[model samples]
Target chain A: MSSPAEYAPTARTVPTRSRERAAYDAETVHAILDDGYLCHLGFVADGLPVVLPTLYARVGGTLYLHGSTGSRPLRTASDGGLPVCVTATRVDGLVLARSGMHHSINYRSVVAHGTAHRVHDPEERRLALDALVDAVVPGRSADCRPADAKESAQTAVLRLDLAEVSAKVRTGGVNDEPEDADLPHWAGVVPVTTSVGEPVPDPGLAPGTPLPDYLRRFVGA
Target chain B: MSSPAEYAPTARTVPTRSRERAAYDAETVHAILDDGYLCHLGFVADGLPVVLPTLYARVGGTLYLHGSTGSRPLRTASDGGLPVCVTATRVDGLVLARSGMHHSINYRSVVAHGTAHRVHDPEERRLALDALVDAVVPGRSADCRPADAKESAQTAVLRLDLAEVSAKVRTGGVNDEPEDADLPHWAGVVPVTTSVGEPVPDPGLAPGTPLPDYLRRFVGA
Candidate 1:
């Protein structure tokens, strides 16, 4: 059973057996999506599944994939809409147990299954590109030069609505068997984290171009 | 044209365009695969692509997916050989440029397209499970209780040959336009790093179970 804020389970979105770790709430799905940096995009081609890693941004309920106009997925999305499954995963920790069978990783992942289409509307495309830039570094779009007409034409933005989405998360600690409780093996969870280091300036930076506040905060400089 | 020690590029395996940063060398492919912890496994289901994040380990030229027998992908693979595409990506940094069109992420990703079949051989399945546990925390398989017959029967594994594989890598700094080089915007890369924090022991642990040497080294304790 799903809560009011959760997306109703469909035939495909339901968690197979361990429904405890899976959630379909909007808050859960959005949190996982926002915490992610890259997403693996999957689509069928020639009757075979093809998956590629790409950058994406979520604005409200829609996911925008930014790429060059010549890229295969972007091209395919432009030819009407393309069916896709986009997944974002963040590893939290390594769960160690007394038994190998109980070992697992603590992670938060969201999967969105839907159809993606190229954003042909000029206004939407421009905003999507800005959103993508901002996603890379928060508040980055304000400092950068907006894409001119030519650059806009050379880029493509694919839009996928977050309609059928579910998140599966593994949190807390090890689940060792009661029979193996007396084993000598140490069991626990080692936390994993992602942090941004110092910014690496381009070789050809303008003299006295101050680092933006957003960049400084992002890198904790 | 692929060099020796590289898998021959098929129509589907070839990089779509700008193959300069894409590689097929076994060394490159294997290195990227080994560095990754989880992979987004994709397969066609209900005439559409379905991608799920799962634990995987590589042994030579084969990738083994470890999961419950009740899972959808594992069940489908056991039906027959399932056409699958597995992709692993590691984000290195955020590349911020002076123009929105030039912004991108520095990442290393490997995509493998092949058919995955259930590992029916008992010995192979045992080794595969061991490899998976070791992949999570190196040397962990030796420390934990090996999966017994009942545990092995409950778990399922899918093996996919690394026959069609390609690796795409993006490195270095921002690629800003010469015209926008003098822009006031500060452009560079923010390095993203993954690190392990202190370990938290399980509540039901045997008193003073020493941490394994590998675990100590892994967590830099």
Candidate 2:
């Protein structure tokens, strides 16, 4: 793996000492982001740190995030072009073992550092906002309504450039000790996976509207 | 809401004009941590930043995290007593709408700041290690064989004091425009929940060995 240990932001702000796993190159970082659906954003509020989990999408070298204009963080960031750190992660599987100490999970994740700038231009905001929509359901954006003036006014969109980012991943099976390997304890990966179930039709859908193929083919993250 | 808009970390992290959500006291902070099962750990590596999702458990004012000794991040941090930033999040529901632009998700999250220290004492290491095990599945440690010296040596434990932490959350109904609210568009929370299904017994388990209550009652995060 191409580790970018030297490029990660290391301030008192970030305290993890696992330098090697704490940072990675753009390729690794983008791969993790492409596979995940959500991100947790970190920023300062009143001198303390606040983390918020929100829907996000990656476009080229930047991440776009948005929420209600009424949201405190979004409202504030949108108004002042505040800097916010965002992170995305996906849990792949669960490792079960004969010993509690050896049990673990397999996962992939990305963390990025940058300032969030509000997207105010009509066209850019429209496009940026659609990234979020597309992220959850790729082709659904074209099928849905574009934000009208009033709706656009009520939403806040912030853009964070992916200038600095990294990814850390762990995979594979149990690592039982030589002596314990034959101790009659069942040890293996339980393989936890996310799968989408049958979609519930909208109670108010017009009589003959069929389910969208994109939605029907949906698979859980 | 005691919005401490002038906190230190917040001042450093948040741009001058960003609106940070309310500052949380220990009570509120701990509540979010206790309620959520997973955390996104942020750290800088190779000059870039990365985030990873992992299970976490909080006891009093401290958070305990563990991973394989071979894991690069854990190994590097254990070697230098480096501090790491950890975050946890929970999604309450998915807000679907008549229009994609108005759709959103409801969520809660917590972020903690601390310098992770490697647990060297055998007894504390064992206990701290078990805390992680129990966090994933209560009573799992007792049900399984204890980690032998070799197995214990293959794992690494990091301790983080949950002193500087904060939580930002958003919840409610969709923000549909007045014009679109009654446009015959179905709007409401679809209600996404994480729930555990039936457990599959290990193939080699003794024929009549009943499933442990913890494993059987497991709730997905």
Estimate the TM-score of every prediction.
0.96, 0.69
Q: What lDDT tens digits, residue by residue, belong to model 2 across residues B173-193?
A: 666656664554434454455
lDDT of 1 by residue, B185-214 (tens): 888888898898998999887668677899
lDDT of 1 by residue, A138-192 (tens): 8999988998999899888899988888999999888888899888888999999
Off by over 4 Å in 1: A1-4, B1-4
Stretches off by above 4 angstroms in model 2 are: A1-31, A44-48, A67-84, A99-101, A197-210, A219-221, B1-36, B42-54, B60-62, B67-86, B111-125, B143-175, B184-221
State the DockQ, from 0 to 1, for candidate 1. Answer: 0.84
- Tell me the tens digit of each residue's lDDT in model 2 across A28-139: 6777787656788766544434455668888877788876676667767766676566877766656667766667666676767766888888988888877887786566
Residue B146, candidate 2: Cα error in Å is 4.2
Q: What is the lDDT of residue B24 in candidate 2?
A: 59
- The best candidate by lDDT is 1
Q: Going through the candidates in order, what is chain B's TM-score?
A: 0.95, 0.81
In model 1, the fraction of reference contacts reproduced equals 0.94
- What is the Cα-based TM-score of model 1? 0.96
